[model samples]
Target: MSPPKETNNKINTAKSSDGTIVKAGPIVKREKVILHIDGDAFFVGVEIAKNPKLRGLPVVTGEERGIVSALSYEAKALGITRGMPIFRVKREFPKVKILPGDYHSYVEYSTKMFDIVRRYVDDVEEYSIDECFGELTGLDKPLGMSYRQIAERIKKEVNEELDLSVSIGLAPTKVLAKVASNWVKPNGLTVIESALAVDFLQKVPIKKIWGIGPRTAELLNRKDIMTAKDFYDKDIAWIKLILSKPYETIWQELHGISVMEIDSAPKTVYSSVQKTRSFHPSTNDKTFLWSQLSKHIEDSCRKARHFNLVPRKFSIFLKTKDFEFVTALILLPSPSNSPEILLPLAHAHFENIHKKGVLYRTTGVTLLDLMADFVPQDDLFGSNAQASKFETIHKQIDLLEEKFGKIVIYLGSTKNAIDHKAQDGGTDSEDLDKNLLFL
Candidate 1:
């Protein structure tokens, strides 16, 4: 006989090292363990990590032009929300500490955080810049510690070494682990074993379950399935009738079945890639604006090359100081990731869309309609040959930059863009010619 289709079913199982193969009555459904660790107030924490004095103070980062990107817990407590304009924040909370974002340092700390996680478990997934997933299965024996103990140790090490708090969750599946990790905030750890899964899930609202977005949650709510427990209580056949593969996978995951495995590989493909930068005090200079757009285009091209992708189309945009926005789109002559070819085309469209005397604060470039890098087709203008030559030169430039620094070599048009005036009244440049780091 099979387990009950309409209720919380329990089956008697013959326990094995692998945790499957049930015997015949009530048993705990066990599955592989996953641990998810997420940084607390990541950008703000990075700033605090650099200056310990910023700790316990209300901190916010962003708005070289005018919007808040991130806020510390203290600032959040004071009702300072992200995306809120800094001028409003100044008026409401004058004591709030505002700083410009340091993406370079943030990347450094992100690498350190992942490296620390890798020390504990080799199968670590850098889920995001400030989050990671570590497979905890089979790590118990080699480490000589229980899964929860290992998680706690990882948490402690991160705090002691990075001086940043992390919220960690350990559970049978990635979805559940994410839920557990988010259940508590800012230095909390929650472990959900198979036996405790249902009880814990029962308390969570249907909308709170990972992977179930608002539309799906609303659909489930209409059916009176309002809690994780309500979704879990449905039989397999009933779930199959209502949802497709991904939601079905989430259902199985909730039932202690590891349908999704940990993926350690970095993402290789992107539908679109975008790069944007905000300028301080805004500018109406056409040359400076084009230079900023060129910088963004080059940055986007570099990212595409990293993923071995080429875009068939490109979109460029300018955001004016008065919040007016203008955009232009172009179909590439052929799929390409070379800024040398793309930037000139971008300039052609920028001239058409850019209105004179508009104080623009931000410029952005987006590469779209991407596909795997492929050989370009011959065109009427026969730019293929010139494109190939530019491609070869860019490869050499890429190598030099990789060895020396990202800004070692640059196109003349983007030279002014390279030495960007910092929002905080400083000049931020990555010119290794000025200073080099031995490490």
Candidate 2:
């Protein structure tokens, strides 16, 4: 059978050690276990860990209009929430002190944590600069106690080596492990024993299952399915009928396999991004369409900061209901990460796209011709001023975003035209405004 496509977002179910099909609970990375190590309060955690003085204070990271992008568990309990506008966040819990996140620090600690995981597990996938998913293959040597032993070993090393805590979830499949990892926060390792998966999966809300976020879960709930078991009992067509392409992957992974191809080679890290979500389907108002494009480009730039390379070219992809496809790319004089520059180009691309006079079902903005922060010597201009300018401002804005949270800061004047801004007024500088910000 072609690898069974994931049909749901719930991954808590798996075949047990005794050959019984059930839900996962207190999962430990067995021979087949996938240990997903997810950072809790990542940016906030790192800052607190770096400086002892930051501990236990309701620390919000970001700048003006910067909401809580990542809240420490301590902060979360105080009723502070992610995406709550910083202004509102303060109003809700006025006593909390906010600190901007440190990107370089996050990357540094993330590297150290993964280093420990590599010593024990042969397979490691650095899913992001902050999180990792690792496979502990060939654990048969430790006999009956290997999974629990390694899980504990990983936890101990992280505590001793980095002084940082991570939540670990273990299961037979990547999806379950990812969900399990999140079950415990800050410092926790939860294992979903194969036989107990059914009970565990049923108790957790569908949204808690990872792939199904609030929006998808609401849709699932409308269909009267609220738990992993509901999705499990759901037929293939039921899944297809109710879920989108993304949720399909969740369902298959719940069964201990995934449609995703896993290999040692890490997937290409996107240096640029373009995302467009269809509005109420009217697609008629050009102004609304333009806003979406602007939002798309600005969102990509936020993530561009994480990739470490600036982009010099912007590419546009437009799709029409007629299934017509059009793509165009523009190369700038220098690499850039500012929406102000890219949005104008995106508008120009859309203007070209509009010439066909067909309603668009999709639109995308891509940054291409990516290069190092400093461009190499050019024949036309021996000492390029533009490249130097792009680098300085890029770093500055990145610093501001890292500190302020999301799109709270913008290039020159684009700060006024912001979407995805949290109640604190911080906007998503990254793609999750469109993709995971894809993970």
Candidate 3:
């Protein structure tokens, strides 16, 4: 890949609110305000928000033998860590609440959180289900408050409205904002102003810098850059020689420069998409196993369509109760995300891997070698032309499902998986009404 375009080294001056002339490198730096908001122990917080009695008690989320997905601060204080199995937690902290994850409620709270942030800043990036970044650079005059004050108010409003604790960080760059936010936890607020940027860097390890993973951290350690301050103190010429363009941008951001902007749009491209699920009891029923694979394919296709992408290859795998895997891979007749074209191929390949009397516990499907949905492909004719018809019908079905709810209209083959999910405590109340239609 080509290297990132180099920026000039010219310095520029700007007037601060105090009318003091401030100088910055490369780009003319104004008071570039970026705020990051992170929900504290998100899934556990949601459970606590739903049931106030759970407050101050050790709470964890995950069920059906899955590892711990989330834990409350109280649970953390009690020496409970994430990814610890539920059965062990039961054996250890028997009083902790280990409820099944309510994904629907989590999504609801996430939407509410984003809605609250949007009220204050138009440029809001939903970084994750529990994190968001909002731009407040030019809003100080109109909002009648400083950037720090705006961040403080947002934290207060989220707490009062959602009853969930959130830690917030304000900085001139997105990377610094993320660092500041993580520095404080359980409803703390931190600000990394340009004047105080070096102080913050000096206190953090190089590994703690946003975007610096273990491999990069080790590389920097070899150069004796143990702290964020050490990395920041590197010469620009050496940084360009040692690190890639992305690292160079982070280096600049550490110095209180805004090289990265908040991206608010949903991701439209992916290298691959996968869906998987395990049922309560293992089954050897061939039809039931195929149904599960069908459902996974349908779900993967749905996500591909949401991103306007198409896959050229698809694969399926089934895990046996004895901890053995049966897998198959096939190149598609055409690069497509329409379930109609892909499901038949999935079933055809499954035939090669299905072993009689081998009870399977889980099934999964992955769409790979993805490309833009609109990319040109070989012209369809006769039997191949039917794919176009299927595409149009599935597009309509997608819109209807988006409006009404998923499974309101679905493939007949997936009905068995839906029924199995309902019987095994997988389907929630919202899905029950429409799933009954298939019966």
Candidate 4:
């Protein structure tokens, strides 16, 4: 990428009430253009997309987990916040609608949304399920449209195709693009030209800046730096003296210099794979808890197998009704991603951690110290042969799952978790039927 271009023109100048000239800063000419696209109330939006009648209603997801995961703008207006207990919402806002989360549908919509942007820009970063950053520099001529026009086209395509609203920001840097995208909400399109960036920054609180958190905002506020413009006006040397490298990068971005590059590569490696599920109504049933943990093992192993990775060690934990965690870490005899090997070990260790009469609300498993799965050399004990056989069986099972649906064929231990309706986002028979329609 070329270095960000700057000009000496002093733009955003204004006359104060006393007729004095107020200069915000020099105009930093646009050298790079980046677009940030974010969905409007993503989870709730997906639910509304699947069923249009749910729109214009106070809706929230996470009914299965007994807490709010995402809420519609209508729900937010009614003082319903994310992570708030569902029982309270029902008691306080009885008119509000609570629905179970359907992550399968969310992932499908996310893929389609980002794919729409990828049609326009090759360098698109899938920042999250509902957000992405695309590099739009130098595409105006080939596309026969301005950067803003290209952004508009992408946004229009996503909205029309997915029946979803996305807010887009066009700016010279990622941070500014993020700010511009959030400037207006739901279905908004805002452009922060390099010359006008300072004008926008003047109104944005320091805490609202992309990477700055509440603690950092408090620290900056101690020094009376309350707005993005305030921080941007400070001396570069002073910023370096007080803040860390990340903040310095933000400052450079605030100066219309693109310090962060768009990362578009797909993730293939992981340090660990963790799967957790919280269910409603804590249970002391050992079979249910084991089934939940077994399901987690299968899910985590499936992910590891997708990346051709094996874990050298793994851990399991159970969350009690009081929110206390009882965890145990186990080292494997060999690195493997097959749940056949993990389930038995987890069952044996379950006894050590399971306290009788303890009501648990969550079960989790983490596969750790992962490395590439390589063919093992033959051993005298024939354990390698057994593992290879299980691997082949799992490969066939994966094919079956791809053809049918996830968990169509799972271990007997996981049957209770799948058959039971009280966990994994509280997906019951009715929710399953609705989800099948989306597929």
> TM-score of every model?
0.75, 0.61, 0.78, 0.82
For every candidate structure, what is the RMSD over all alpha carbons to the true structure, in angstroms? 7.4, 11.5, 7.2, 6.2
Lowest-lDDT window of 10 residues in candidate 1? 15-24
lDDT of each: 0.81, 0.67, 0.82, 0.86
Whole-model alpha-carbon lDDT for candidate 2: 0.67
Off by over 4 Å in 2: 1-31, 140-145, 258-263, 267-271, 274-365, 368-439
Ranking by TM-score: 4, 3, 1, 2
Worst 10 residues of 2 by lDDT: 430-439
List clashing residue pairs in candidate 3. none
* Among all candidates shown, the one with the greatest TM-score: 4
Best by lDDT: 4
> Judged by lDDT relative to the true structure, which candidate is superior, 1 or 2?
1
Where does candidate 4 have its weakest 10-residue lDDT segment?
A: 430-439
lDDT of 4 by residue, 125-148 (tens): 999999999999878869998676
lDDT score, candidate 2, position 13: 46
lDDT of 3 by residue, 1-439 (tens): 5454465666555433224333433312355888999999998899999999999999998875478999988889889888998888999999998898999999999999989988889999988899999988778879998666677778888898999889888788999889878877778777767666787789899999989999999999998999999999997789999989899999889888788989888657789999988764788898888888888988899999888888999889998888787788879867888787888888878888988887888899989999988634436655546777767777887898899775566677787877777776766635654543332
Q: For residues 350-404, write the lDDT of model 1, one tens digit per residue.
A: 9998888788988999999999987666553688977877777777777877886
